[model samples]
Target: MSKSSIYLPAGFRFAGVTCGIKASGKPDVSLIVSDRPLVAAGVYTTNQIVAAPVVLCRSRTPSSTVRAVVTNSGNANACTGSQGDADAKAMCAHVASLVGCDETDVLVMSTGVIGKLLPMEKVKSGIEHAVAELADREEAFFAAAEAIRTTDKDRKTESRELELGGESIRIAAMAKGAGMIAPNMATMLSVICTDASIEPKEANAMLRRVARVSYNRVSVDGHTSTNDTLLLLASGTGTPLQGDSLCLFEQELTELAIQLAKQLVEDGEGATHVMQIRVTGATNDASAETIAKTVAASPLVKTAITGGDPNWGRMVSAAGYAGEPIEPAKVSLRVCEELIYENGTPLKFDAASLSATMKEHPQVNLDLCVGGGNGEAVYWSSDLTTDYVRFNSEYTT
Candidate 1:
């Protein structure tokens, strides 16, 4: 698709620039500003040891409106103690001064190496340059997406336009993530904007629900980052959405989030295949998700898929230990359309054929039925490869 297809919602401007935080000297800073106060809500990483920016953002999230977001990639402002906290506040303060808003009206996010301090001199210069270059255009949005990347192979962006209350409304989003991914949020940063008018209470509720099924259902290496943040902003520049229109907007938002989440898995560090794990027949949705996550996060299962080996036993074993009761005789499993296990017994199937099928497709489907219950859930994960090990081993260098 054309890059311009990822258009920003009305009244938003974006800029991205290099701040010398990355050794490669790629763009490492991004600023997003709204023309007016917008309803905002955010979901952050649940990690106990949060980054400085996470702490700052969490403190201001109680407010109903926000005007700007400042983010940087490389040199995560984490574990610097009081200094890190001060630096995070300074970043917001700088943005607020330039945008003519209170410090609380701006949010900050940073990602990259942990336990390092931010280069305040470079950051100040980068923020000033970014603010000066801000513009409402596709190129600006693309730059903002690119500046938020640390190890991502590609920039992730999505947009949708729909008519609400006889007026056109647009929703656009951009995200950065490749590794350190798991449930309870991932090692990622994302910003979503819409021109539809929405109240703060309703917007927050909608974002939480959307995240549970999208960002919360993806796993790369079963690791949650300290800097994960997902923010949603509503500019109120379009006709107000109510009742069915609000529901429609939420549905579209969920779809867009899912699209970006899937992209993260597809672009996972050294990932060759994306696995869609669907668990059904459980006693409840929670049980189903627990089983699916167990299978999706198993290293053995991930490695088997990476090598195009149709080793269904590993998957079955992972599901059994998901802390949920399951009858061996009632369990059934399938990889794509080929049945590998039934009635708790391994079925005779052509291993070569299944392996070939896996090699031919970038996506692999694993369906498991544990019981006759009505609960069902789905999760996405990436196969583990040798390169994933090598890259992370020397990431500090």
Candidate 2:
């Protein structure tokens, strides 16, 4: 299928450039421009050391619209104090001047290592070149996608079609991630462009719901990034999906976003298996997520999964430590349809056979039952690997 065929409700253009800020000389800057102003909404990382661009982006939304988005990979421009904020603003000012829009109408994002200053000069020149180079072509989208990479080995994107307000709405999204991906919003960076005609309120609501299920459910190292960002912009180009018609649009958006999010998780530093953890029969939905994340984030458990060991005790104990009050005696755990533990006790299953099952597929499911309730949560994650440690140990060098 064509890359742009995902979901685009309006007209938009993208550009990317290589600025030497990152250690690698590949592309390190990108531009996302709407043909016109777009109603936009964003979600940022909970990290205290928020990036300079993130702060500025939040301030300019709601009251004002956005016309251009400037982003960079390599230096997060976080924890750099006032100077960082100025650099972020300068990036926006440069883009706004090129696009002939208000500075408030321009947004900026950054990713990669933290506690670093943005090479403003390189970014400034890059933005000038990117603006003059913008083109409404597929090659531009692919190149822009590449320009935002940090450690990612490949570019990731997804799209879907839905009928809203008696018209068809197309939703297309792209993301870059490879490490520091334990989500309070992962160290991930993304800019989703849509052609759906959505108001700011509707767009905000949709973004909230999507983040909870997509970005919120993915983790790699249980560490949030200082520069995490996920922004959605509707250019009002495609069919206008509103009210109940929005239900289908929301579903499609969440699904595509989740698909992209999962792809990033699976591609984590040195991930080999994509594990899906489902916690059911919890006291409430919140409790279910607590349990799921606890089990999913356990390095010991993740390593065991990667080694193809059906260590049921590790899974059960991880849930036990999720901080949610649960009756241990009533807990149950399963891996890929094989009941490994029941009533908090080991089941009569062949360990070698189960280990074989775990190694046979790239996907593994951990089903946990807290008993007596229907609350549940499904999360996407990856197994820990020694290679993962080696990759990050010298990432800065």
Candidate 3:
């Protein structure tokens, strides 16, 4: 997206700068700031080995006082012991001082290499430069999005506008993720900004509910990151959405988040096709999601998608092994809208036609029914390609 096409939310400013943190000399540090006090909520990775930045930000959010987020790429600050913890806090402290806010009012996030110490001097300098350059412009917002990227092929941004309580509200978000993704929380580092008024408690609840159906439903490579986090800040410059208005705001938030999540899947490392796996007729939503994730995470299924092979056996067996209650005799499967399997019997369909359809489109949809029930779920996944393996094998070299 270009600067002219983007939306800059009211009361928010963004900045991104380079400070030698990345060997490629790209913009590696970014800041998202608000000119006024705002309600904030966050969702983070569920990995047991959490990153220092995630720990610090998790304790400071779901508040009404947060003002800024300082982030850096090229160093994840994960598994680096106590020094890593100290570095994370220092980053926040520096941003707080620069922005004239309390230490707790500044949140921090880091991505890139894991198990490495952050170059604090460079990070501190970058923070100073970013704070000084902060601007309320679409170019600045785009820069902030670019600065958080690691293996992503493109920067991701989305915006939504809604009319609530006779007031116009806007929600804009940016995210960075291309690998090490799973449905364990936010799945990546994302910053969401809005001008709608909301309470801290309500914002927290809404974030979780929105994340459940959006971020949590996306899986890329099935590996969860240590620094995955999604932070939402509401500037409350518009009318406070309540009653039906609050519900509408949440719906828009969900739609915006899903757009971002799909972008991440599309940008998955070396990805060629994105699979929209839908599971229906399960016992419950949770069970449906389990089956969907299993099918999406299957290496056999992903590779089949990469080769445009209409292989229904891999998908059926994946759902059967999801540990959920599944009756093979009652299962149905479709690949690229072609019913290839039904009720434990394989159908003789035009496999060449189905394969050609998969090859012609970047999005491949698979529908699976595990049993006769009402539960349903959808998951976004990327096809496993040789390029994906090659890129990951040389990621640290």
User: Which whole-number lDDT from 0 to 100 does residue 395 have in model 1?
Assistant: 91
Q: Write the number of the candidate with greater lDDT, choosing between 1 and 2.
A: 1
**lDDT string, candidate 3, 1-397, tens digits:** 5534676679899999998889999999999998799899999999999999999988998999998999999999999999999999999999988989898899999999999999999999999999999999888998999999988888899987777877888888999999998988746899999998998999999999999999999988999989999999999855567899899889999999998999999999999999999999999999999999999999999999999998888999999889999777889998888889999899999988899999999999999988998889999999999899999999999
Q: How close is candidate 1 to the true structure, as a TM-score?
A: 0.98
Taking all chains together, each candidate's TM-score versus the true structure is: 0.98, 0.96, 0.98
Candidate 2 on 46-149: residue-level lDDT in tens? 88868888889788765326898888888888889999988988898898888888888998998877898888888888888888778777677777888988
Q: What is residue 276's positional error in candidate 1, in angstroms? A: 0.4
lDDT of 1 by residue, 1-397 (tens): 5756675689899999998989899999999998799888889999999999999888877345699999999988988999999999999999999989998899999999999999999999999999998999898989999999999998999999888778888888999999999979966999998888988778888989999999999999999999999999889854457899999999999999999999999989999999999998898898999999999999999999998898988999998999987777889999987889997999999999999999889999999999888888999999999999999999997
Give candidate 2's root-mean-square deviation (CA, Å): 1.7
RMSD of each: 1.2, 1.7, 1.3
C-alpha local distance difference test of each model: 0.91, 0.84, 0.91
